[model samples]
Target: MTDIELGALLADASQAAAYFVDIHDRAALVEAANALDFTVAAANLAAADDKDALLEQIAEALQFPATFGGNWDALVDSLGDLSWLPAPGYVLLLDHCTDLRDAAPDDFATLLDILDEAASAHARAGVPFWALLPVTSPDA
Candidate 1:
């Protein structure tokens, strides 16, 4: 999607949710989020083959507090409450997730569920929280 289109889609809190996009669109996605004053965070999951590594990458990317519990619950909690990263909205880019998705499908599915819940929570509070997964192809 073009930066303008991305910006428009991200501007609406109610419509915010997890989405898969072309890997090449990463830059445009970040630019769009930044243009809308949203906090943009990118987590490189290239080496996150396990749940622990995945959580670690995400915590680091979003700057989770030291108190973060490093678990699925903690992830949902942190994502739902982004007071530390306060902004008009949030955009998280999950980069290079193909390997993880293929290696541990269950973990990836759980992550998506948590992300969806977080997005729903944010939407209810009128804050956009988008999780964008960049894949090499449409089927990825």
Candidate 2:
């Protein structure tokens, strides 16, 4: 399905599913982040009192059609020491990964690896995790 359609589906999905939408572009990302009340406070990543809250806040702020550079370590680190969702399933959308493919291919791959690890960890604990990655033609 198209990103728009996928987004619509996620919006209508039950809370049992963890949903995330990754986008490209800093301004658009900021706009999306704002829309969802997510504060782009990467500066305080290590000190984030609640990563889930941050994710929820950022999810609420996210908008599509934006591009982002992949920060593999940062993204992976963000997932560290986090609690799992209190549901049977979780969904995540890693947007703009394709954009980072050229400039930061290694980081991009590392980010995917981290995402996979997160999914595996959730699954091992009996929770389901899903992730979505968006790519533009120019991205490839």
Candidate 2: where is the Cα deviation over 4 Å? 1-85, 136-140
Q: Which one is best on lDDT?
A: 1
Q: TM-score of every model?
A: 0.96, 0.42
lDDT of 2 by residue, 34-114 (tens): 343322322211222343433333333232112212234444544432332233344444443443445555544554567
Write out the backbone clash pairs for model 1. Answer: none
* Winning model by TM-score: 1
lDDT of each: 0.92, 0.40
The sequence of per-residue lDDT tens digits that candidate 1 reaches over residues 17-103 is: 888888888888888899999999999999999999999999999999999999999998999888999999999999999899999
TM-score, cand. 1 vs. native? 0.96
Error of 2 at 102 (Å): 1.6
